[model samples]
Structures are given as structure tokens and as C-alpha cells.
Target chain A: MLEVSREMLAKGTRAGLKTTWELAKVVVPTAMLVAVFKASGLLGSITDFFAPYMGLFGLSGEAAVVLFSGYLVNLYAAAGSIMALSLAPKEIAILAVMLTFAHSLLVELPISRKAGSPLGYVLIVRMGCSLGAGLLLGVILS
Target chain B: MTVLWEGFLQGLQGVWTVARVVIPLMIILEIAQGNGLLQKLNRLLARPFRAIGLGEEGAFPVVVAMVFGLTFGSGVILNHVREGKVSPEETKVIGTFMALAHALIEDTIIFMSLGAPLLLLILPRVMVAYLMAYLVNRRNQHLSLPEGHHIQGIN
Candidate 1:
């Protein structure tokens, strides 16, 4: 049992290190970009444009950045954006649920197709579930 | 220049925080996999999976994806489909559910570290994915495509 555990620990550490490296590659660069956007005041205009729609999900306009990153780029990018901002826990929770249902579309959609699911079907289901999750969580949490 | 520098520093800090959460979680997941925990989980999930139109074979990929993330999970799925262990209909159901809720542990932890509520983050996605997949399975059953219309083996 001890031997098995030691092997598990070694393997887990290796996998952990690799995964963290992958995450850092995305998170650090994206976070810096978002911070640049915030510092330069670009984020404000972007926020203003998205605020009303975001309000439907009980999130601030700034959350659009997180959602956009998660949708187009990947979840680590979304995390970077989230770190650069200050949001209430409630809004974070809402974004969390929404993104879980529909992040990383450009990559995962094709993977689904290659697994025998249609591209269009996966796309619609993901986006629909994301919006639906956001809406429902918005109502319940608010 | 100051703004850029500050941004770089903040990004590093964020990476540190996220790394603290991610690395440990990955280790725990690895240990679980080493213990054959996933097989037990697959068995536990098989019945509920069938309610959404997946079989014993289909449940493995979905469970793997739910834990590991879609990219890895889809590899198992593709292998199973190629082996004829999972049908097109089953693949569609797996895709629907996994699309909505894959990578549950890692994604949820990342959000939780950012102050998202844990239960709120997980429960809703699971519930929504199950409900949506169940609905799609029902619809697929009714539509029952003509013999040749099934997506000829995925490339």
C-alpha cells in the first residue's frame, strides 16, 4: 500500500507540474493583457457597452471580458480576466456556472465532432445551456 | 511603462494563486485515479447515465471528461466509438452532457478560489447538463434517423 501511494504521489506531482505550466502559459499573459486594458481605461468603455446585457445575468458589465475570454480563448484566460477585476462573490458564482457550461468553444466543438457528435448540435447545446444557467442562477441568487 | 510593469506583476500574483489551487487538486485527482476510484465512480454513475441514454460504455468517457476535461475525455470517447462500444446516438448524448459539464473538478476549484460558491458552481451545471441531455435523448428517440443518416464513423 505504501509503495502504491508513493508511486501515485510521484505521478500526481508530475502531472500537476505539467498542468500548472500549461495554466500559467495562458493565465499570466491573459491577466497581463486584461490589466493593460484596465489601466489604459479601455476596459471601461467595453464594460459600459456590455453592462445592460450582463445585468440580466446578475453580473457587472466587466464580466463580459471574462465570459468572452472563456468562450473564445479558454477557461484560464477567463481566470486571468477575473483576477484583474473586483467582483462580488455572487457575480463570480454566476460567471462560474455559466462558463462551466460553455467555455472554450473553438476547441471543444471540433473535439465533440471528432467523437461522433455534430458540430452544430454541440454548439447550440453548450451556448443554450450557458445562457440558461446564467439566467436561472441570476433569478435564484438575486 | 509603469502600467505595463504593474500589469505583469499582477499577472504573476494571479498565477501564484491559481497554481496553489490547481497543482494540489491535480495531485488528489491522480491519487484517485491510481486507486481505481474512477471505475467505482463509473459504476455509480452508470444507472443515472442510462436515464440520459448513455450505456455502461458511454458512462466511462462522460465520467472521465467530467473529471479530466473534454480534450482528454474525448480521446476515450473517440476510441470507444471506433471500437463500436458506443453508438452515434449514445455519442450525441455523451456530447451533450459533457459539453455542458466537463472538467468539473478543475473548473470548479478555479472558480471557488476566485470566491465563487462551491455548491452553486457545481450543482447547477450537473443538473442542467443532465436535464438537457435527457431532453435531447428523448428527442433523438422520436426522430430515429433513417439507416444511412447516422454520422458515418467520425474521422
Candidate 2:
């Protein structure tokens, strides 16, 4: 039993390291990119544009970063962006719920299709769940 | 420039935070899988899946995806579909639920690390996924009803 557990430990550690490496590749680049966007003052304009729509979810425009990256890229990138921003706990919770329901569409949608779900159905259901969750949480939390 | 450097530092910080949670999680998950714990969990999950209109064959992949996330669970899920273990309608239901609620542990933990509320993140997603899956299952049932059967025959 001890020998088996030791082997499991070793295997687990290797898998852990591999996952960490994968997360780093996305998190680091996305964080850096957001920072550059902030420095260039472009983030300000972007946020200004998005703040109105984001308001429906009770989030500031800054959260557009998290939403966009999570939708197009993956969750790790969203995490990286969230790290760089200063959001209220409430806002963070809302974004968390929203992104949890829907993120990484470009990658996951195809997988759903391969599994026999239509691409349009997956896309619509995920996005609708995301936005609906955000809306409901916004009202309740606020 | 200093902005770029700052960005790089922030990136590293984000990676560090994630690594702290992810590495340990992977280790624990690996141990669980290695010990056949997942099979036990799968058995436990099979019953509850019926609440959302899934059967035994549909349970395995949904359980795997719920814990491991869709990308990682895709092999099991796709294989089941290809092997005709799960029906097309069941596949749609699984797809809907997994799309909303997969990777519950890792995703929730990572977000919790960012100071998001734990229960708030988890409960709503689970409920929504369940509700949506139930609706889809109902729709599919309605569509598949035998010509002579009334809509009320669904139960």
C-alpha cells in the first residue's frame, strides 16, 4: 500500500507540474497584455465603452477584460486579467459566476459538436446561461 | 518600458497564485483516480443523474466532466457517444450541463483565490446547469413522444 501511494504521489506531482506550466503560459501572457493595455491608456477607453453594458451585470467596464478573454481564450487568461484589476468582492463574484457558466467558447463549442450537440445550441445555451446568471446575481447581490 | 515590466510582474503573481492551488489539486485528483475512487464516485453519481433525465450510461462522462472539466473529460465523453452508450438526446443534455458546470473544483478554487465568494460561485452555476438540463431533457422527451401518446404521458 505504501509503495502504491508513493507512486501515486510521484505521478500526481508530475501532472500538477504539467498543469501549472500550461496555466503559466496563458496567465503570464494575458496578464502582461492587460498591463500593456492599461499603460497605453487604451484600457480606459475600452472600459468606458463597455461600462454601460457591463453595468447590467453590476460590474464596472474593467470587467470586460475578464469576460472577453474568458470567452475567446480560456479561463486561465481570465484569471490572469482578474489578478491585474481591482474589483470589488461583489463584482468578482458576479464575474466568477458568469464566466463559470460560459468561457473558452472557441475551444469547447467544437467539442460539444463532436459529442453530438449542435454548435449553435451549445453556443446559445452557454452564452445565455452566462448572461442570465450575471443578471440574476447582479440583482440579488446588489 | 516600466509598464511592460510591471505587467510581467503582475503576470508572475497571477501564475503563482494559480499554481499554489492547481498543483496541490492535481496531486489530490491524481491520487483519487489512481485509487479507483473516481469509479466509486461515478457509481454514487449515477442515481442523481436520473433527476436530470440521464441513465447509467450517461452518468460516467457527466461525472468525469463535472470534476475534471470538459476538455479533460472529452475523451471519455466522446468515446461513450461513439460507442452508442449514450443517445443523441442524452448527449445534448450532457453537453448543456457540462458546458455550464464542468471543472467545478478547479474553476471555483481559482476564482475563490481571487476573493470571489465560494458558495455564490458554485451553487448558482450548479442550479442553472440543472435547470437547463432538465428543460432540454423535457424538450427532447416531448419531441420523441410516440404518435399515439399524449404530452401528459411524459413523466
Candidate 3:
């Protein structure tokens, strides 16, 4: 019993370390990039352009970075952008749920195809569910 | 330079925040896996899974995905399909569920760090994935199940 617990602990620590390493690389650089964008006012213009549409989901236009980063890159990049931007808890919650459905689309989409699910079908379902949920959450929360 | 430094620090802080939650959860999950808790949990879930039309084979990947998220869970499900343990139809149904809700612990924890309420963050995906899977299972019988390699070839 003691040996079993020890093994679990060792295994867990290793797994955790691996995750930390992977996340740290993405989080730090993306967070830094977002900060630079915000400081340079680039994020502002971008936010203004997208605010109206993003507002439909109860998010500021700035929240688009998180969504885009999540979809195009991976979740850690999204997390970095989310932290870089200031948002209400409600907004964060909505984005979180949406990303949970559809983050890492670039990678996961292909993976889904390889797993024997029709590619287009899974893609539509994932993105459709994400956006639909985001809209619903936006309305309900507001 | 100042902005870069600030972003760097903030980024590291973000990593630290997530690390705190994820590290502990990973440890607990490892312990659970070691103790046969995952299998026991799977056994407990068998009836509920069937009610959702996932069947016994679907349950393992669902549980794996729920714990580890899509990337890990999808790999395991794919392997099962290769081994002929899970049919292509079952893989599709399972994949649909997993795509919506995998990595429950890690994803939820990270979002929680951003002040997302646990219920709010967790429920939407689970509910969406559930309904999606149920719908697919019901509708799948009418549709021609796509061959795995052909599906891959579409890319």
C-alpha cells in the first residue's frame, strides 16, 4: 500500500512537471506579447473593431484575442491572453465555457479526423456548440 | 522594455497560478488511477453511460477524456478502435462527447483561477457534450458510418 502511494506520487509529480513545462513556454511568451500589444494600443484598436460582435457574447472586443489564440494555437495561449486582458468574472466564465468546447481546433480537428469521426461533422458540432453556448451564456448572464 | 518585463512577469504569474491548481489535481488523479479508482468509477458509470448510448467500450475513453482531456483521451480511443475493441461508430459517438468535455479537471481548474465559478465553467460543456452525443447516437443508425481511413483521407 505504501509502495503504491509512493509510485502514484512520483508519477503525478512527473506528469505535473511535464504540463508545467509545456504551459510555461506558451503562457509566458503569449502573455508578454499581449502586454506589448496592449501597451502599444494595438489591442485597443482591435478591441474597438470587434467589440460590437463580441458584445453579443457578453465580452469586450478584447476577448477575441483569447478566443482566436485558443482556437488557432492552444489553450495556454488563450489563458495568457485572458489574463492579459481585464474582464469581468462573468465574461471570463463565458469564454471559459466556449473554449472548453472548441479550443485547439487546429490540432484537435485533425486528431478527430484520424479517430474515425467525420472531420466536417465534428468541426461544425464543436464550433457550433461553442458559439451557441457563448451566446446563450451571454444573454443569460446579462 | 518595461512592457516586456511586465508581460513576462505577468505571464510567469499566470503559469504559477495554474501550476498550483494543476499540480495537486494531477497528483490526485495519479493516485486515483493507481488505486483502481478510475476503473471503479468506470464501473459505477456503466449504467449511466448506457443510458446515454455510449455502451461499455465508450465509458473508458469518456472517463479518460474527462480526466485527461481530449488529446490524451482521443489517443486512447483511437487505439481501442485500432484494436477492434471499439467500433468506428462508437469512436464517433465517444469523440463527440470528448470534444465537448474532455480535460474536465485541468481545464476547469485553470478557468477557476480566473474566477470562473466551478459550476458555470463545468456544466455548459458537460451538458452540451451530453446532448450532442445523445443526438449523434440516435441519428447515427440512419447515417452511413464513415470509414476511419477515408475520414482521415478527407484531410
Q: What is candidate 3's lDDT per residue for A27-122, written digit by digit as tens?
A: 999999999999999999999999999999999899999999998888899899988889887888899888888888888888777767778988
* Backbone clash numbers for all candidates listed: 0, 0, 1
Candidate 3 structure, TM-score to reference: 0.92
Writing each residue's lDDT as its tens digit, candidate 3 over B31-143 gives 88877888888999899788667777778999998988777788888788888888766777898888788888888887888888899778878888888888887777656
Once fitted onto the true fold, the runs of candidate 3 whose alpha carbons sit more than 4 angstroms away are A1-4, B143-155
Total clashes in model 3, counting residue pairs 3 or more apart in sequence or in different chains: 1
Candidate 2: stretches off by over 4 Å: A1-4, B147-155
Candidate 3 achieves a global lDDT of 0.86
Per-residue accuracy of model 2 over A1-142 as CA lDDT, tens digit each: 4124777878878987898899889988898899889888999999999999999999999999999999989888998999888888898888988999888889999987776678898898889989988888788878
**Cα lDDT for residue B60, model 2?**
76
TM-score preference between candidates 2 and 3, better one: 2
- Native contacts retained, all candidates in order: 0.71, 0.76, 0.76
TM-score of every candidate: 0.92, 0.93, 0.92
Candidate 1, chain A: TM-score? Answer: 0.95
Error of 2 at A39 (Å): 1.2
**Can you tell me the DockQ of model 2?**
0.69
Highest TM-score scorer? 2
Interface RMSD of each: 1.7, 1.8, 1.7
